[model samples]
Target: MKQAVIFAGASVQPEQQPPVPAADLYVCADAGVKLAQALGVVPDWIVGDFDSLGSVPEGENVEPFSPMKDDTDILLAAKYALSKGCRRLVFYGALGGRLDHTVANLQMLRFLADHGAQGVLVDHAHWVTLQRGGTAVYPRRDGMYFSLFAMTEQCEDVTLEGVAYPLCHGKFSNAFPLGVSNEILAENAVVTVGRGDLLVVYARD
Candidate 1:
């Protein structure tokens, strides 16, 4: 499957990182250029204000935006990638920056999901993604903690298994945080939602 990988400007620890995997397109958001280059990525597009770059790199691959624009640089890069027909996308350096930017980046995952693409937000302590409605199976990581949160008004018939606390056919709402900090016990864990979508956060302290 053709996919895109984007790098943003967020603080990240070396050890607690997730791989961006192979992608058909590589995009960088301002300072994200450094991270992308460090990962040996040749970006097809560099979308952002030239501030982080000192000056725009000389290439047709560059897409400059006004720093004062309403959208964040990373969001702009993502939209561009999607427009170019990338269906599966993953982001690095997208969290741990300004709190508001981090939250906005997470919200972008929902936008991608609703538009028929998959978006994953990978950071030092967690890997997060939005599920419109489906099952997600995860291979266990010893120190990882799993949590589920309703992304819409409500998520119905949620089920979780192979974890320390298992639930069946549960309903969750945005008003309350009913699923948070559950342990992974075995080789794998499965989460299923019968209606609506939820945010699945696989985290560690």
Candidate 2:
């Protein structure tokens, strides 16, 4: 299974890139081409309306999509990545933009997850996801914090381990802040959910 990374046109903070495993393909979405170039990484494919791309990279791999297309640039990039046989797609610069775009990107998580692709949105201070049924683990960092927010109407049978506050088979609702500001206690923290999707945000304090 090939791994792919997609970059979107959002404000990226310093030290936002993690040590991601080298991807078979790197995709740039619209202005994201400039972001990739600034980072000195040439993407395998670039897809977007090109309105935001000031100078197109000198390559045939750059494919321009219509600005009036129904899908967002990032979403188009995700589809391209999947078409290239990528089983996992990691996203960068996916947050801190227009609030509508950010929320739309979050919804894209469910789209990818439903299609059997593992999608993660990494930003300056946090890694966010709307995860379905699964067991997620967070490796320990010196001063990292993990928070989970219920994205759907409710998340059932949720559990948290190795944290300042722990939960077991608990239910979380979208209207409350029941799972906010939890700290890690062990080298690796774990969260398990039996049903419903969770919006998890992990950050460094």
Candidate 3:
């Protein structure tokens, strides 16, 4: 798979770093360069307005955008990744710090899904992704909490198996968090969404 790994937002704690897989492309969003360096990754491209970075970084790899831009720095980085033909994107440091930014990243994942790609937001303690009207199987994690939410107004014919609380063809709504804090019971969990999008999250304590 052609994958891109992007660094954005606050630096992750050393102990909280997940097992990051190697990607074909790497990108940093402004101040995210600091976190990229911490991870020993040399970004192929750096995209941002330089506001968070204090000053424009002196490098030919840096792709500076105006601060008055409509999209966020991370979103710009995502666009660059897509332009490079990367369909699987993993974003580090995309959570925490500002609550609004975290929400924005989630929206970015939805955007990727709409564009025939998939994005995963990795933070200090969470692995989040989006599922669009399809089936997904997740490997069982002994102590982790698995949760799913309706990203659209309604997700119809949602089925969940191999979890502590199983659902059969249930209609999920964004208005209610009915799929929160479930645990994987079988060797793997199967989630099928007949319509609409689903926001899936795996959290560690």
Candidate 4:
């Protein structure tokens, strides 16, 4: 059961990076090499098309791809992590900067979920993940905001606990953001989905 951490291009400065996990491997995707280096991280592999890299990093394990590829660099790095038998994947630098890239990384979370590998996009201010037919629980904290969106067309039998607006066996629609801007009121909060998928966004602002 190996774990992996991937650094992406759309991120903040190294000094402002989040607390990273201790994993078997660390990866750099395109411009992520810069972030990795700035944080004094020697990644096990450097992956991407090298377009945003400016200059190829000095490394032996470089997995280069074409600029015309279908997947984004972060997704490519995630695939590499899966190929190496990683069961848990955490992505940094996948959020912030461009809205399109952030959306793309959310899709990568779906890919990880479909493959039975858990993945999350994390930063100092936000933590995002995908949930499908499962339950996700968190230790509730005051001033933190939690929201859920239907990842599929709709999420069925959704349950919420310990939140300002709690729901039990509720249905959420992608066309509507009915589950937005909720706050904690207890020690713990749980979100359960009996059908479909949900995009969970937890933020502290």
Which number leads on lDDT?
3
Residue-level lDDT of model 2, residues 20-42, one tens digit each, is: 45899999998887667666677
For residue 115, model 2's alpha carbon misses the true position, in angstroms, by 0.5
Residue-wise C-alpha lDDT for candidate 3, range 1-205, written one tens digit per residue: 6999999967567457776679999999989898888878888999999898899888899989899999999999999999999999999989876888888989998899878899998876788999999899998866789999999999999999999999999999999999999999999999999999999999988
TM-scores, one per candidate: 0.92, 0.92, 0.97, 0.95
Better of 1 and 3 by lDDT: 3
Question: Which model scores highest in TM-score?
Answer: 3
Worst 10 residues of 3 by lDDT: 11-20
lDDT of 4 by residue, 65-85 (tens): 889999888888999999999
Steric clash pairs (candidate 1):
none
lDDT of 1 at 139: 80
Report RMSD for candidate 4: 1.3
Please give the lDDT score for candidate 2.
0.83
By lDDT, the better pick of 2 and 4 is 4
- Model 4: CA > 4 A from native: none
